[model samples]
Target: MNDQPLDNLDGDRDHATAGSGHDGEDHLRAPAPRVDGYAPLRSYAAIGDGRTVALIAEDGRIDWYPTPDLHSPPAFAAVLDEEDGGQVDLAPVDEYRMRRAYVVGTNVLVTTFVTATGTVRVTDSLNTGVAGRLPWSELGRRVEGVEGEVSMAWRVAPGTMFGERSPWVEHSPHGPVLRAGCVTVAVPTLGEMTTVAQEQDISGVFTTSPGSRHLVGLAATHDEPVHVPVPEDVDAGIDRTIANWRVWSREFHYDGPWGKAVQRSALALKLLIQSATGSVAAAATTSLPESWAGGKNWDYRYSWHRDTAHTVDALFGFGLREETHAAISWTLRTLRNPDMQVFYELDGSEPRPPRELDLPGWRGVGPVVDGNPAARQLQLGVYGDVMGVVRTYVDHGHLLDAETARTLAALADAACDAWRRPDSGMWELPELRHYTTSKLGCWQALRCAAHLAEEGHLPASPDRWAAEAERIRAWVERECWSPELQAYVMYPGSDSLDTSILLHAHSGFDRTERMSTTIDALRRELGHGPHLYRYTGMREEEGAFVACGFWGVAALAQVGRTEEARQWMDELLETANDVGIWTEMIDPGTGEFLGNLPQALSHLALIEAATALGSGLEGR
Candidate 1:
């Protein structure tokens, strides 16, 4: 599929609608159409089994999914390649308005399509493990008519290895078996739909009357011997999968404003977890350009030390101690090497190296790359990221073994020696700069080390750490701050403002008038009305980092600007799709989404911002 904007299509008007009530009619105007095939982003609900995840659009299309495993090749690649990309679509045959939600407290998704013919509901989920044991290994979809008879069609096209490799299918007495390298695909049907192999893909169609039901399942195998189950067994697998999600989601303790959004984010985080290794991926599918075709595409299938630590903190906040502990233990096991690379595969495999692919990128963005070169960059902040998670565990009264403490201390000592070197900051820019945020991260590490030592949680030289932290702080204040610009620069001696600096106040760097001035300066220079850019000119050069906008709201709330923070918070919330999902970036000019869709970082920032605003309201 070409990456041209969907609005450029001939029948694009079929999906147009006025924005909801937020600011005013003009504030909600849709952006201009593009010749590209990229559609206006839709709300997507994620479902997973702690191994692989599937993204089901509000319109009932499974647009993005990595099969067999989170890091495995994508089965539904339409999210990246619109036309040739594979997808599993189950929707009404007639034009239908849709409303969707998750089964309360579970990852099972329920999408209802209301058409002139009638209304039908579709439930989607991956068959999950039972009591920590792998199940029948299936992706199940159940469609039932809720009202009048509604005709529906379903299609399944499994793209091979990021759209480069195509699978071959042959029929047997049992059913169909698909082969692609080490992966295998099997489908069992409970409806009267013909399964036929079309040029490099397989598809089927089914319809139902009121009170009727249909079921379809896709199964795959890795190293183990494969088995194809009968279609009748699909119902049992669906029941067990739904039950598993329900029981697991019951562990959530969050019950605050934006509770639904929080739960969804938690589910997303859970979906990214690799059940076999307990490691969490940063995102599901990769090579979705951060800034369309501008060379900002990255692979997020690996686990980043920074992202995992933040995820642990977020999960801890929701009272998920078991999951938090599992992640921490995974970190300890995988990060045994003192010279930790930035990221690793879920099973603690080697760092993923950057490799170019033959397929086109999402929205016609070229250079569809796989793996990430950032994995090998010397980012000093990783020291802080690791230490931060350790400190959080110790502070929260979670047990940290003596060996873990000793390893942490040694890691901190390594940071002390490495902090002076130049490396890529959190943003992962290609060019290495003396990033102020990176230095601040090192400072934070030493400070956290000092705190842990003083609390008797670890054996460390507090005096040395304290002195080192102060030295870094002085260097930042003296070298990184631009008195002429009245704000801290992106790097030393550079006047460019980076949205990352907004993190200082949240990280407890400095909350005085100078910090406030810096925050306000970032708001003025980077703010695109309500949606702030990560840095100036990023929209054309790099994708607008949507997380930075939430960071702005959190920064304002942190500095006691409650009203303005709330206003911006409302604006950000309003930008979410009807079902409340956020992408990595939002187009400032058109309100169209850019970059990767359903980004985990963007949702995490939303949770933080919403929680901060909710707490402020309670305090008042």
Candidate 2:
């Protein structure tokens, strides 16, 4: 647990992920997914028009980003310390052949390198606020050539972390400004401070031809007040942030059937929602390790109240109820500080503890960690993740004003006086007990606080939360229903077989016969087929848990087993990652992407298994 040592500066980019020569112990070994040029968390590819997000990589190297948001600190970490983290590279000076996408309904990325003297493309985006976030975060990247004659060579390095800060280069009045504390960054095609190879780089070297565009922007500004950036006004703010994400994905109203993989997992959970603090980051890169799983490296940027309560109930089923009521008013105003923290720090406080970062992870699988001990673990499945987002924000009619109905009646009387204590459940796991999804998350938070206090809007004591939600559904079917390991076990005496009980069959608490024979006993004890593992032995401890493979495809589409839930959600979206993003573990036979990248609970469990395979499951 290296707390802080990562050196490599005085000339940055001297390569070899520069977290070098560490003898003070723990240079972290056993890392296999990568180690040298760091790129393969599914070869990156993520841009954002929301508040902040960037990943890049198929060799065009942005690596990982964080500056004006997403809990801002990282100013790029080379996807976890490639020569002291922070890179902007931009491909082609020779051999190339990339191919990204996104620019359709926008989060604007585009890639396309194809060298041997032609096609450049590039694109990327972060610029926005024609109607949403943009106080100055513009990333822009243009580069277009589209045929013969290509020769790019950019660098823009920033790098810092475990060393705390670096990148300095002020010139302002709209030019090279790249400070690094209250982060100022601007990169107007970076035409100076060149060292490259000795590396203090903001390098240059351009040369296009057919059509030629080459405008590389960067722009940051955490404490805001430093605009002036005008590479033609940040390429017209990346064409008005790609027309504000294609008018929010053409008024996104999901037409079902993997409609372009559910609008690219709803624009990768709308770039993990950082809009000033609608705080949704459950993945935008952090320590990135789960492969060779050492400290199982984590950071996931922060803000998790159970992945923003299942991403505001899958963006309120794509009707997009204002980022699920601004991530349920930023998770009930950060649990009013009396505790229930399970993740925070998109400025809502509570992180500051998890340290361990002398740096190596993301390719070395060390203990890179940043800040998260599950915010002092007590994850009683966040009371069914805050009553499944207050029962989908009061069944979409929305009216729990009075301080969100006194914080959902003090979280349904504190989940009915703590449903049989012993927490750290929903995989926060620190050895507390009773975890059958923390006793069905306090029996689905007193059955959703007795349906939000019988719709009278939470004044709740509702018959002592309906008799402690029927004594937590009869104490999780008498101590977590193991019946000799037929199913439900990861806790009461532990025969362990969880994937968080495959979402208690979409929380009807067992849909026909012990969660349908515990989904074939969790696909024969933590399946590796459609990738499962979130409990029982944890597959030598990591990969395969991409939202428990969409909660076993929404528990086989709410039990009717809809054609094995559409062939296990079409083989789990064919292990997404060239664009339709999905990471937080995979690689059960090289599907690759392990731990963190666009993972907001694996795209909110693939939009709740494509909205339970397009609903109509009579009362489910």
Candidate 3:
């Protein structure tokens, strides 16, 4: 095996040994295990048309995508299932090294493969319409040979709905039309390519010589009265889609270290936003699992009030005022019950009950779930999440309507009543513990309410709210703090450290000394190198929560430990796949990514931590 670095294998290089090694005598042997699953995370870049998104690997494989809509069933689900699940692969047939990147300021992925014959750049994207509507949408692939000839093979397989069963397909001159109940896929092809309909998928082959260019489009839609756009129209659609994303990205105010990662996070947030209702999902895919067959998988596609509020606050920091305002409105409208629920569907519908599916989950994690039962749990922290958004908007010069003010006042009163009760904390654990963080979260709500009233933004009894906030704070100190441990425990009567307390600084419940002490204690107990887990003694169960690690970074920066904070932040960034994407968690021992990936919580924390670090450096 050649020991040369893969990055050195580029277009101008010669005699590069970049691909996985294969033996001539074992020509029928299966491929070797990739350095990473499918391909290195670094080899992939994401592209989206706001409605749907696709991840194109450096090797030109569309390994992960939710077609038709961000929340729809995936057309390429290989990111989770690898072998059994389907993927749309368009890569060189020979040993070729690949380089990939997103077009600047847009969610357009471009991957260039350099081979002994020639170099070919393949651009992949889901087409979008003028008004941000996806009309006759298709996954467009444009291949341009930059140097030498490369033989490329294309395969499109729609996996069983979340690994249920393979769909049926039919071939046509326009392309293959794949049907799976309500869903249909239309692919556009050229005359040179040969299309074959297999048992469950359609496969095609096309070879581009030097200086030749070709286009292929995969369109998916429901059973409705719609005219499928022509191949030329789809090509134009790709151009429009790129322009749309570029225009949207220009709205971002961030210009800092890790600019590309932040932009990708912002774009991902945009893609998860339900345009019609303005509700943003926590992620596009659910049940991708926190650990393989670990029973830790949970659905994240639903909108959690806490998650969306955090999203709005993060977007507000990036000068995305429109999205912030829309998200706030959606949140307020969705939680109209006065007693806010933790999660809701994109259209503000009530969340369905949590029930496990009979089918195997991603990577054989059994019993994949749809709806989240966390919605029904009593998470007192939701009041704080709501108040956080409202107060942030008010502080940022966004005027609050009378209804919003009334809601805040009512919510503050509710928090005052609920703060004394023991409930699930931010982690949504089944056991109802007297979580210090949950109590503090309620305290934050009341404190922020008092501030809003003091600032004349809301009608609230400031004195009463302040008194209640003080009581909650005192209770947390008396019951939740463990003086011997020199840190706040996960809950009263428990010595276990929790990363959730890292938010004490951001929540204004604690200053540098208290937060710093808690940080050091958590590091001692839960830190796997620089990545912090949610709690100690849960090694056999949960993976290291990705957001918790970022929370520690933010906490460190808040306490004037900027150097250590930056170091931790860089370490967290290193955990991201090649494309700078993170899952919900990481394996504490090995640092292998776990959970449904491209998690919004992890990205939201990244934005907040980066903003904190960036602001701190600017002050110096």
TM-score of each: 0.90, 0.37, 0.89
| Candidate 3 residue runs with Cα over 4 Å from true position | 1-45, 80-84, 163-166, 170-175
Q: What is the Å distance of residue 101 in model 3 from its true position?
A: 1.5
Please write out the lDDT profile of model 2 over residues 1-620, one tens digit for every residue. Answer: 10122222113111111111232223312222344777677767687756678877666778777877766778777777778877787777786656555655666776666666676676778788666777777787877776788888877778874568766776544445666667777677622223332233466777776776767787777776777576777876777777777777777786555556666677888888877778888888777777674777778788877788777777777787677887888888887788767787876788888778787766667878777777787877787787778788888898777877887788788788787788777777677777777878788878888877887888755788878888888887887888886788877777878877788788787788778788888888788888888877878877888888788878887878777777777777766655677778887887777877888787778778878876724334
Against the reference, the lDDT scores of all candidates come to 0.72, 0.73, 0.73
The C-alpha local distance difference test score for the whole of candidate 3 amounts to 0.73
Candidate 2 local distance difference test against the native: 0.73
Task: State the lDDT of candidate 3 residue by residue for 1-620, as single tens digits.
Answer: 11111122122111111222221222222222345355533334566665666766656777777766766666567766666556887888888766554555666666667777887777777777888767655788888767656888888887666656568876666545787656788777643777777867878777877667777778788665435567787767767877887777788887665565666677766767777677888876667666555677788878888888889888887888778888889988875674468888877888878877655454456557766778888998888898888888889987887887887788888888998888988989888888888998899889999999999988766999999999998888888888889999988888898888887787878865777898999988888876777887765577778888888888887788888887777777656654455677887676566776567888888777777777666665
Local lDDT at 494 for model 1: 83
Residue 229, model 2: Cα distance from true site in angstroms = 1.0
Candidate 1 local lDDT, 408-449, one digit each (tens):
788778778788988888877778888888998899899999
Off by over 4 Å in 1: 1-39, 133-136, 194-201
Pick by lDDT: 1 or 2, better one: 2
